[model samples]
Target: STIAERRPERIAGLVYLCALLQPSGATPADLHRHDPDSALVAAIEMAPDGSATSIRPDAAAELFYGDCRPEDVRTAIERLVPEPIGPAMSTIDTSAERWGSVPRAYVRCDRDRAIVPAEQDRMIAEVGVDVVVEMASSHSPFLSQPDALAAALVEIRDGTA
Candidate 1:
């Protein structure tokens, strides 16, 4: 959404896949903090120097890959890295003239723990997407349900979603 807002002319549409969809002037941190159902919030560990944040490794499965295969979950956990705090803390500036003009779509993961279903619904209601494709998968649908995710993306691209 922020990217579309900043470069609306270059973007054809916006697709959020179990991703952050906060409103203008709202940061990712702000949204997570407000969402009581978000498992990620409890798992978040700030860096000692306050430069980055990472989830507790032990909480990875429940927070991110609850519906995923065991091996896939292990691999994803192995690949996890600390996310810089700057971007999550930065508030985006959006307007109807820019971000609102682009057709937006959301692929809501019903089984997502990081961003729970209630939070997903709240964001969709607030941001107003053109379409929403729900999946009975985890937050990492690309790993757990790639075919369905790809199909939804194709549908969004073809304007048939």
Candidate 2:
């Protein structure tokens, strides 16, 4: 969603999710259509604050283990936390002027299997980022390439890229 639509209080920067970018009114079922073999609809129990209190086993397995190495996936699953995602948050307008005004960066996970490289590239092109950094890792780069991800964040923060 546009910053104006979701969190208008902030300004200047944007960190778009390079993994999955869906159109308005698109449901989780659409992801399954995109990748029937790997994309699993996560069974999430929502809390009062719009965060997921729990993710079912099947969902977790598909999300974290599908593309990552066994050992790395285990670490990510262990550290996974409740992610805040409201229903309205999914309906983003990429064409909105508010989104276009902000400086943005895209981190492309080249080895990501959850969101394939082609899909990531398509989103990057559609969203229009100021900088693009390629990470030779899976969807969960924080688990597979923490130091590199940190460095990319630093570079983006410093406007060096």
Candidate 3:
């Protein structure tokens, strides 16, 4: 289903369901990922490194706003990003607006193609997040550097990163 444009709060309900998916004892695949803290780390560790090709827009119009569409890049975005149209980055707004009410942490991927440092910084400051960790890898550093990702997540977990 298409997002009911502008109905941002429904996204939270979605997140709640996501968290409940793994309520204590569940299979790894059946499990949900959750942290009571609203700390959000876009973990740009694997942010896209943008190719020179034309791109198709992800559901987020913001991503395709200022670029020309190269047929190949357009093909890539469509092919690469799976659906359920997850991540709901649209939910990022909900997380930011409620930052003061919950702990917020951010991990910015140094080589993220989707989010360069400047825009990422703006988002951090705008949200007044509690912590910001920079990981020096493209969008999916967790895949390539689980240790670092684990370390960062631990810091967020222990409140000592």
Better of 1 and 3 by lDDT: 1
The lDDT for every candidate, in the order shown, is: 0.90, 0.63, 0.41
Candidate 2 per-residue C-alpha lDDT over 1-161 given as tens digits, one digit per residue, 9 for 90 to 100: 44543554476676654455544455433543655455433355566775555565556656545556778767767877776565424544544556555677788877665666776776667546788888787667776567888998888889886
Q: Which stretches of candidate 3 lie over 4 Å from their true place?
A: 1-99
Model 2 segments beyond 4 Å from truth?
A: 4-9, 22-72, 79-90
Give residue 59's lDDT in candidate 2 (0 to 100).
65
- Once model 3 is optimally superposed onto the true structure by TM-score, how far is the C-alpha of residue 93 displaced, in angstroms? 6.5
Candidate 1 per-residue lDDT over residues 1-120, each given as its tens digit:
778988899999889998989899999988987676566888999999999999999999888888789999999999999999999989998999988999999999999889989989
Q: Ranking by TM-score, best first? A: 1, 2, 3
Q: Rank by lDDT, highest first.
A: 1, 2, 3
Indicate the residue-level lDDT of 139 in model 1.
Answer: 88
Estimate candidate 2's alpha-carbon lDDT, on a 0 to 1 scale. 0.63
Q: Count the backbone clashes (under 3 Å) in each candidate.
A: 0, 0, 16
Report the poorest 10 consecutive residues by lDDT, candidate 1: 32-41
Task: Report the error of model 1 at residue 67, Å.
Answer: 1.7
Best by TM-score: 1
**Candidate whose lDDT is highest:** 1
